[model samples]
Target: MEPKAHHVVIGFFTLVAVAAALVFALWLEKSQTDTEWAYYRINFDHPVGGLAEGNAVLYSGVNVGTVEDLTLAPENPAHVRVLVRVDQNIPIRANTKAGLVLANITGSMSVQFTGGSPDSPVLNGSRENPPVIEAQPSTLTSLLSNSETLLTKADQLLGSANELLSEDNLENIARILENTRAASESLLQSREDLIALLEQFNAAGARTEDAASRVSGAANHAREVLGKLEPVIAGLADSVNSLQPTLERLDRLTADNEKALDTGLQGVGELGPALRELRNTLRTLNSFTRRLEQDTRGTLLGEETMKEYRE
Candidate 1:
């Protein structure tokens, strides 16, 4: 009897559980029916990121629908046909696009709906076609692949770098550093020569400055000399002017002296004959005087020696 009671209890509980499950299933169905829904289709030439049914359909990050079906397009085997059931009031327009999105790094993907033109009419049925967007390669996938390749290449490069930094290379580097040091020392030794050359240039510049100063001084001196000589030249001109009349008078005197000398010469020429006659008269007078002297001497008695001397 207890076993039968236990069986009965188990059967009652099983019936209640089945009834509850049916009620829950009916509630789910009614809830699904209550939602206003619409169907649309998109066609693609390739698998859209491995999109499957029940994938979320998002419009600007808002989940508005889900993918209902995926099949090969009837006309084109290469093309895939996707059916989407969205909320009825969502108002997908004719120009809307259905693109696949990678939702995660683990290759999970979703459908993104966008580009509904306001002027275009709203899509009604499955016949209303939304344009399928070609899926671009995901950045995450590309970055992951690139990271792997980069890490592999980095390892190879690191190995090569390690080989390059071997002991022989280190010694070569050391030798190069030593040579550089020697060259630097040689350059340092030449610094004094460079400084000396600069000093010489400075001295030359000073000398040039001195020469320029001397030239300026000479110019100033020349200007001063010319300034002093200007008045002297003016005085000389005045003196020359003052002496001009005297010079003219001297010239006139010289001319007059020349004329007087000429006139005197002419007078002397005119007196030549008169002077000759006078000279002859003087000679006769001298003879008369001599005779008178002789007479006187005779008269004075003792002039016979004077007469013989006269002959």
Candidate 2:
């Protein structure tokens, strides 16, 4: 009987020690979770793929706290609200940004805080309304969104390519290629003619160049001749200018003697008739003198000699 009582006592003490240890552990865990902690809310506009309660909250790559709860935003179903607890000593500023980051290869996620300036005011809120840390789309979310858009565009491109390579279009392309080949063959056959045409064009261009050179030389020669004649033309102009006064004086003299010159011309015409009448009067006087000489000679000779002469 005494041995059984001793065993009961030992069992009781052992049970008490285990209960005390359990209570101490519970208190330690509670103290660790609740002491010097602050609460905050983060609103994410994109879907949080693998984030859940009890995930770590990191501040600039250091683990500071853990997420407590998650719910859809009351005002908009598209947004999600996440409640978190962090160390109260952390200087969560107004400009601090929050985002979800990948934790491991299993795609586990955690909330991360970044970008707080020293001078920014502390983020503050009441117990009922915790300060909201601005949330950004996770890298995975952005990559997925971009991939979806790229796939859609690729599908459209493929559809267009299919239409472009249809049977009718391919047939048209073949016909164009056949026509181009025929044209190329025709050009190859006419190579000599094309070369001859090119040669003729080159000859014509050379002749045109020679003609242009000759014309330029002729123009220069004409300019030189005109330049040489400039002085001769100037001398002639000077001579004409020097004779201008003489020509004017001759004009004035002719004007002044116009009446006297007319009277002298009239007198010369009247002198012609006076000279003819004087000649006729001199002829009559000479005839009378010759008759008187003949009579005198006959009287001086004897009357008998004159009679004999008459017989």
Candidate 3:
């Protein structure tokens, strides 16, 4: 029994559709895996809590790849070596850091990448041997890991506080507080005296400031006087300098004429009495000349002259 033309057409179309669907599925698989991956190694010295293989890797909060494997480092058993596959598009730089992050409060964690500078070169590696990326400890991981230690310390602190706040210590503290209260009350009562003292201090400060201002003014006046006197002082210095040559000449003359000056002084001293005698003789000569002149006049004047002369 041969199929009808319409049925045959439908069957052929169905086969073609199935084949197309298969091809699409294969292509989708290929396309999904077509993204190039870069492998990197991270060594964590701390426990990777809730971190597992197949966990999503995020780059700056965007899912970029997945964690491939996790194992204990063969060389150092204390370190956990984590192998991650990141998208080649995401620049896993030389300075890239890897750390585990909590996805939710349920404690599910995933590998995350952070701190890749733009200037850094892209980190390269293969499946056989991947480049090592530094592992950063996350805040949550550190808190969780140190929870015990923190609790222990907190317990010790509480114990110490309890011991310090014992009955005797509490009594001492109460006494100190009472004393402080009394001091406060006393200070409150002496408020007026304190205010008076503060006013006195203020007045003293004002007086001191005024004195300082006067001193500064005096200093300025002194500077001005000194400035004005500078030229006068300079002129006096020049005068003294000019007198140096004259003084030197005088000194030389006095030294050269020492004996002559002594003789001249002695002669002048001896001439004093002689000079007095000469003066007296000149006076007498003047008086004689006058008398002689009067006699001559009387002779020439005859009787009237003789009568005046007799009188």
Among these predicted structures, which one has the highest lDDT? 3
lDDT (10s digit) by residue, model 3, range 1-311: 35688898999999999999999999977975998888988889999979889888898789988889999988888789989898887788888888888887888788888887899998888888899976989898899999999999999999999999999999999999999999999999999999999999999999999999999999999999999999999999999999999999999999999999999999999999999999999999888678668786654555344344553
What would the per-residue lDDT of candidate 2 be over residues 1-311, giving only the tens digit for each residue? 99999999999999999999999999989988677777899999987877899999999889998999999988998899999988888878999999998878887889999988999998765447799876988667787658889899999999999999999999999999999999999999999999999999999999999999999999999999999999999999999999999999999998999998899999999988887887777777676556546665544553322444554
State which candidate, 1 or 3, has the greater TM-score: 3
Give the residue spans of candidate 3 off by over 4 A. 1-36, 115-129, 138-144, 240-311
* Candidate 1 residue-wise lDDT, 111-200, digit = tens: 777778889987687435643434334454355547878899999999999999999999999999999999999989999998999999
What TM-score fits each model?
0.40, 0.46, 0.60
Index of the highest-TM-score prediction? 3
Q: Rank the candidates by lDDT, best first.
A: 3, 2, 1
lDDT of 2: 0.88
How displaced is residue 249 in candidate 3, in Å? Answer: 8.8
Better of 2 and 3 by lDDT: 3
Enumerate residue pairs that collide in model 1: none
